[model samples]
Target: MSEYKATYLVVGGGIAGVTCVESLAILHPEESLIILTASSLIKNVSNVSFYAKTIVKFDVHDTEATSLHKIHPNLNIVYDSLKHLDTTNKVAVTESGIQINYNLVCICTGGIPRLISDSRKCKRILGIRDTESVQEFQEKLKNGRKMVIVGNGGIASEIVHATRGIQKIWVIRDDYISATFVDPGAAEFLQDTLKSNIEKNDSPVLRRHIFSEEDTLVSLNKNLKSAALGPDWYRKLENTRNETGEQELEIIYKVEVESVIEREDTEFPLDVKLSNGKTVQCDFVISATGVEPAVSFTWDIEPKFGKDGGLAVNELQQTSIKDVFAAGDVACASWEHAPHWFQLRLWTQARQMGSMAAKAMHSKITNEEVLQDFCFELFTHCTNLFGYRVVLLGKYNGQGLDQNYEILLRMTRGHEYIKFVLKDGRLQGAILIGETDLEEMCENLILDQIDLTLFGDDILNPDIDIDDYFD
Candidate 1:
């Protein structure tokens, strides 16, 4: 590749990286920018967000209480790989071995699929690594096919639900899925709901609760959350403890991907392997893998660690490197309110981090005379599950809720409403699995950041006036 130069260097081309460049161009249009990716820009993975999801719905609105629907927008992406970097002279080289100079650099190389093992036996899934691969995989699903997506996180389950009318599917979870987010009963609530639906449909389906390498990570420390004092039920549940629950009970081995392969009698087939030593034969395979911050540029600049040699920054998004800014998935987040400082990695956090970093970068322009917190606001998220639209805000640890909290249960005429709130009244987090209108109420409650302390603590009693908050 021919050598190029830029005043600002933005690596990777995912949502975070793209947002980073857009922010920079908005802030420093006069500065030359370099966005380097290793492959075709358009084909690189991007995030498939429930937040960005669109749908068609007729609207009758004058002004207030307007209806919102899907609005599709054309997106453009570009990519070129980086091969070298010289932090001292602030010059970098690309994979094509082309050299370029920069004034400021932002490393957002995104993440690689953190598959526990590199075995080709298991069907590779798109967790958080790439968005394009997932879109392609979804396209393959639209072409009429069956697939077995392994893993139990929100991503896998979301994919399972999205492909519902289209693809015949089986989702295997060693233990409970998303045990981290929902409580045991809640996870069980979800597991039972999905499993029963899958069984009722009689689509070729299987769920395993036997064992997994992920279970081994049950004790490992998360970057953001620090380990708290007492024991947590979800942790044990995630570890697959002996519990009185009907979990498809299929003891299929992750290594048993070979066994399922023979079951796929289809003439057009996509081979799939699992970490459990099992083999699956499907028309396609998708792993809902994850991504990490890209910090290859920072590695050589200073002291580094296991991966993403990123310099630590406070909440303001300031890095160890002066005037050098970082944001989104690229910024290493510290735990704020809890037993531990768990690493914060999510879409909302990334975007918030990016925007905050942009603000800080601008602050450098005359800048602040006083020493600020050097902080970036962390994020929380809301999502949809099949017919159920779920919203999770703030940090949700595996531990059960404190006694001061109340579970608001409401069945209005027929709509079921269940909302959880902290004793202090802030909306720690909420889930809306049913009652579509309740999501609106919940979103409003969260958005307004109201205090429920004045109201009765018995939210599950279903008599509280939620309209007041919205009003």
Candidate 2:
């Protein structure tokens, strides 16, 4: 067995792991570090443009792990899967039989999609997460006449919007569309766009920032991990080919997939039974239910887990185990969350958490104190839903506030939708759909804690330039 040593070691090559190693390399140039990943590529953030303190736009690129060697001479990249982590001895053993002794270790293993069906052995049922899953779905979609998408999150939202030509049936647990991101008003606006065939500006979809390898990654094992797809993963690849001129869209609300049964006598091989006592035969099932932290490798170390099945981490991103830290989707913040800030598994948080975790690790080693990042002050999300720019700020859904908040809304069919959540006459959260150009001002208002009792409903008036009012 070969043995190696590094002053710092990180597992997983997703945005979190890559950002952590890059930050450490910059902060401690004299120290040597290693990045261990199961995948052949590492996620890199490029073309970043910050609109506010925490709200930013960026693109993700999948780069070859070997090419990262040029960034820092001391940064070593190991292409191996972690099998066991010994927190007491500070040793990590990989599937390749390499034991790595590390001074400090950060777990950035990301997450694995929670499968809806127990029969993962079946090729007909699929879960979307990495490029491999998308490819598998694409191959199946070629001859697929019908597909049942189960879930009401970003993944399912994008899939329904991107996939045309197929008879798409969505199984949403919530009554409204994109319920994870928007409320009913915004959902209605998006739903209207989804039903209308008014051609979207396909030009913007062409301006993608994805980079992939010619040779796909070989699965290391059954538990091989990969980074979740970032924003516009669907826009980059549009598979719109249907034999029928009119695409059929159906929504089964407030229900879930009860069971998926395979049948041999039908043209469609699968029959999906719903909780609402309905069974539909479809070509395949797309399970975007959600994800669980990829922390199975840490069973030996036994890091404290949160209710969400993620490794419980302090504000410093340190796990319960000494000298072990976790970031990205794998780490769930155990500290009391800031009023405006709540955790949502997104690319933005992954990058931020990874960078902050590096600083926390460095400060611990140097005996220095570091303040919590301002990014944690408020939750800001920017993404596209139904070909519309969607921005969510602070308590977008009035989460944790109970019935104490008030809402103000303004919507124009086929144009824009805006909603503001106010508590005690202060802007607590806001959702801006379409090119509202109000995200910056809304974010600032929420951050400044300015009272807007006098403005009332006028805050959303189209004639009033909200940016000028804030300035």
Candidate number of the best TM-score: 2
What residue pairs are clashing in model 2?
Answer: none
Total clashes in model 2, counting residue pairs 3 or more apart in sequence or in different chains = 0
Give the Cα RMSD of candidate 2. Answer: 8.4
Model 2: CA > 4 A from native: 197-227, 240-246, 298-301
| TM value for model 2 | 0.91
| Count of clashes in candidate 1 | 59
Task: Report the C-alpha displacement of residue 268, candidate 2, in angstroms.
Answer: 0.6
How does each model score on lDDT? 0.44, 0.80
How close to the true structure is residue 374 of candidate 2, measured as C-alpha lDDT?
88
Q: 86-127, model 2: which lDDT tens digit per residue?
A: 888889999988999998999999998987864476678899
Model 1 alpha-carbon drift over 4 Å, by segment: 1-5, 39-79, 116-131, 135-146, 164-175, 184-284, 294-299, 303-311, 335-343, 369-378, 397-417, 424-427, 433-454, 457-463, 469-471
lDDT, residue 143, candidate 1: 55
Model 1: what TM-score? 0.64
Model 2 scores worst on lDDT over the 10 consecutive residues at: 204-213
